[model samples]
Target chain A: MTKHFVSDTLVLLGRSLRHISRSPDTIITTAIMPIAFMLLFVYVFGGAIRTGSDRYVNYLLPGILLITVASGISYTAFRLFLDMKGGIFERFQSMPVARSSVLWAHVLTSLVANLISLVLVVLVALGMGFRSGAGVAQWLAVAGIMMLFTLALTWLAVIPGLTAKSVDGASAFSYPLIFLPFVSSAFVPTESMPGPVRAFAENQPVTSIANTIRDLFAQQQVGGDIWIALAWCVGLLVVAYGAAMAVYHRRTG
Target chain B: MSTDPQMTAERVRGPVIQVRGLAKAYKELHVLRGVDVEVARGSIFALLGSNGAGKTTVVRILSTLLKPDAGTATVNGFDVATQAARVRESISLTGQFAAVDEILSGRENLVLVARLRHLRDPGGIADELLARFALTDAGTRRVSTYSGGMRRRLDIAMSLIGDPPVIFLDEPTTGLDPQARLEVWQAVRELARQGTTVLLTTQYLDEAEQLADRIAILHQGRIIANGTLPELKRLLPPAKVEYVEKQPTLEDVFLAIVGDDGTDSTAGAASPAGTKNRGTR
Candidate 1:
């Protein structure tokens, strides 16, 4: 059974990846929004914002990366919605392949596609004079945290994917997700905000994540922020995964 | 439409699909009310019904895609509810809609299914099935580019990848052209000839007459009539034979006027005009 699950997931993942390759536009479209934000912020608003740092692009890069992931995962929900509408889900359910493999394939596809979009955003940031002096270990840690965040958000997208009645409804849930980074430390530091806004910024999952990545890139003092970010990522991932699986079982069973 | 008595007798001796008191309700609306069905091995069984008469609900339950709210159903001797995986291994379902992935090429769709079924050579199996369905020419193109008939054929070809003994077709010819519908009927007949048990649901009375060894009429969530076509016809009032021969149906007139080459040139021309009008709207 485990073997079948692995094989089935790999096969279906190949199918999804083929879809990505054929329509490279989905990735391009996903990356375009975050890149536009990055360009607009780093160039237009860079000088106005005071972060006490030489380059505003460096401070904004981590936040932009998060936005990229948020926008990219909506496509996951959209694709899942299309599959459900197309009756392919029913087809897969009636087959002998492992049941959970269908969900795993979509989740993993979201991970891969989002990773590519993140890399593109980072490359664009580098072209715009955004630099990171972090060591290999620090870079690996950043990648790990980004992957965890993506997994959490992708699982969150699965809920609307499985249950939404319309295509717009399935993807519209990500609007709040894309807006979350703006309320956090992604753009301006929490210190610059009022008491209430700063408190909210400091407490949400995105701020801790953005601060951790920004600090790592700047080679700042290591703090307890890493643990908080990991806790948030892991917590959301567990809850979303559990809920998505419950919905899947209820829908298919 | 002629059914051999010896073949029917042999098929009656062993049933491949059995359902007893199968019932399902969606909240307040009862969809299937105590439906019972038995499909003999190596025979074609058609469940006939009108729209919203619970034909699809029965198919969903028997194929293990949906669970029955009450009673038991088995496929290939495996309980559909408890042994779903085992039953899935022995059966394939081609749903009302052509379930092939639109993004993938016809060849890619077949290869994907074949690989999932753990076939030795997915490429070879895909090629063989594509050729068998006469989709080899369109195999290289993405399914989104294929016509409706081609898509339906590919859907059935995908279901045959594992060579499962039992196949469930839910309204297989629902939206197809007359020529395409005939082709699908021929394919279903060929499956039963090879000792594969076929359970198909249809709303067309002629489709049941053309393909089924036994027909069950499901009306308002109940099997109101079940028997061989001859027996079922016997239950109706005897037809009055006139001295003049009966005329051909309107369908025959339409087919004759449109040409039966299976290309459906009139529809081909008419559909583009229809789309143009819709586009303007």
Candidate 2:
């Protein structure tokens, strides 16, 4: 059964990757929004904002990367919605393949696609004078955190994907996710905000993740924020995974 | 009930799909009220019904896609609710809609199913199925580009990848053109000829008449009638003799408009005048 799960997931993942390859536009479209936000923030508002940091782009890149993942995962929800509406899910369910592999394939595809989009955003950041002297270990940490964040969000996306009545509803859940970065220290310092706004800006998962990635990029020694970020990622992943599996079993059964 | 020798022989050979007092309800609405069906092996069994007659619910339960709220169903001697994996291994379903991935090429879709079924040489199996379905010309094209007929054919080809003994086709030709419907019927017939047990659900009476060895009419969540064609006809009142001459059926006209051979020329020549006659019928 475990072997079937692995093989089926690989086959279905190949199908989804082929879909991405054929319509390279889904990735490009996902990357375009974050890249646009990055440019608008760095050039238009970079000099005006003060974080006591020399380059605003460096501070902004982490947040932009998070937004990229946020936007990219909407496509995951959208694609899964299409699969659910398309009757392909019914066909897959009727097959002898492991049932959970169907959802795993979509989740893993989201990870791969978002990783590529993150790489593209980082490349764009490098060209925009964003510099990091972080070692390979820090880079790996950044990648690991981003992947965990993506997995958590991707599984969260699967809920709406499975239950949404329309394509718009499936992808619409990401609006608040994209809006989250604006309230975080993505563009400005949380200390500069009002008391209530600062509380919100500092408490959400986005803020911790952005702060953690920002510190790693600057080669700064990390603090408890890394634990908070990991907790948020792992916590959300567990809850979302459980809820998504429950929904999937109820729907398919 | 009058029993045909052939039906008796089929019953003796044993049923491949069996349902006993199967029931499902959604809150206040009971969609299937104690439905029972026994489909013999190596024959085409048609469940005939109108819109919202719970045809799809039955198919879903039998294929292990949906669980019954009460009672049980078994496919190939395996219980759908408990031995679901075993049931799935012995059955394939082509749902009402074409279930092939629209982004993948027809060949890719087939290969994907073959590989998932753990078949040796998925590429070879895909090529053979494509050719068998006469989809070789369009095999390289994405399913999104194929016409409705080609998509349905590819869907069936994908279902057949594992050569499962029992196949469920749920309204397979629902939205197809007449010519395309004929092509699907021929395919279903071919499957039966190869000794595969087929359980198909449809709203069209003519489709049941054309393909089924046994037909069950489901009305308002109950199997109101179940028999072979002759047995079903026997349940109705005998026809009265009339002084009027018999007229050719609309199906005859339809066949004339779209040639019996199902080629494009006759369909192209079909006129609005002929269509108007068809609508009145």
Candidate 3:
């Protein structure tokens, strides 16, 4: 069964990757929103917003990457919802293949697709005069954080994908995630916000993650914020994966 | 629709599927209650019912897609509840909807299933099924572009990969037009002829009448009637012969008007191969 799970997941992963490749629009749309936000923030809102950074795009890129993944995972939910509604999910379940391979395939596909969109967003950031002096290790750390954040969000998206009744409901959960960066240091310093809003923003997962990635890109001395970001990503991944599996078992059991 | 006597004797060899006191409920709604069914090997068994009669529930349970609340069911002698993996190894399900990947081409869908089943030479299996289903030309095209009949045919073709001894088709012809319906019926008949035990659910009485070796009527979550078509016919008053004009059904007129060649190009190529395959079996 374990062996079949590996092979079956690869087969189904190829199937969904084909879906993404055939319609490149899903990837473009995922990147488009973050790119537009980067442009608006760095060009439109950059002059007035004071983050003490030499280039505003440098500070803004981290939060924008998070938003890109937030938006990209909605497509993950959408694809899973389509499979559920179309009855293809059940078709796979009824077959001789390992059952868990069905969900794993979608989750891995989300990772691959989101990574591409993240790369696209980063490329756009570079074009917009965002430069990082970080060496290979720092860049690797940033990539690692982003991939962890993407995996955590993707598992969270799986809940709505399995349980939502409508396509709209499946994807609507991401709006708050996209909105989260706005309240954090993604746009401006949390110190600029009112007391209550600042408290919420500081305590949230996005602020720690964005701050850590930002520091990494600038090649600044590592601080405890790295631990917090890792904690947030790992914590959310565990909780979301547990909840998604619970929902999966409840529905298919 | 003649019953092959040799296959009938083969059926007596054993029941490929068996169920006893099966029951299932979704919260407040009781979908299936104490349902019992037995399907002979190498025969077509139709679970005949109207919508909301829990025919799908029964199929879901047998396929191990859903668990039953009570009693037991088995496929190929393996219990559905405990030996689900073994049961899955011997059975395939073509759901009410055409459960296919719309983004992938017809050939890709076939190959996907073959690979999932861990069969060697998935490409060969896909090509063979594509040719058998008359989908070779559309094999490279995405399924979303195919006509309803063509999609259903592809769906069934995917299920035939690895030739599992038992197959389940839930409402295989529910949404199809007359010509597509005939095409599906041909596919179902062909499966039984190849020594596959088939369990299909259908609301259409004529579908049961035309295809099943034995028909079980499920109504209000229970099996209300179960027998061969002739045996079930015996339950009613015998027909008294009287002179009456026989009028052609709308289906016949439709088929005649549409031309026996079939409006869909892939439709005309299936029958001859179907006959040839049946003869060899």
The top-ranked prediction according to DockQ is 3
lDDT by residue (A39-92, candidate 2, tens digit) is 898989887999888999988999999999999999889999999999998898
Per-residue CA lDDT of candidate 3, range B49-161, in tens?
A: 88999999999999998999999998887899999998888789999999999999999999999999898899999998888778999999999999999999999998888
List DockQ for all candidates.
0.74, 0.84, 0.90
Residue range with the least summed lDDT across 10 consecutive positions in model 2 chain A: A1-10
**Top candidate (lDDT):** 3
Error of 2 at B154 (Å): 0.9
Give every collision pair in model 1: none
- Lowest summed lDDT across 10 adjacent residues in model 3 chain B is found at B239-248
Isolated chain A TM-score, each model: 0.98, 0.99, 0.99
Candidate 2 pairs with clashing backbones: none
The TM-scores of all predictions, comma-separated, are: 0.92, 0.92, 0.93
**Docking quality tier of model 2:** high
Decreasing TM-score order of the candidates: 3, 2, 1
Misplaced by over 4 Å in model 1 are B1-13, B236-248, B261-281
Clashing pairs in 3: none
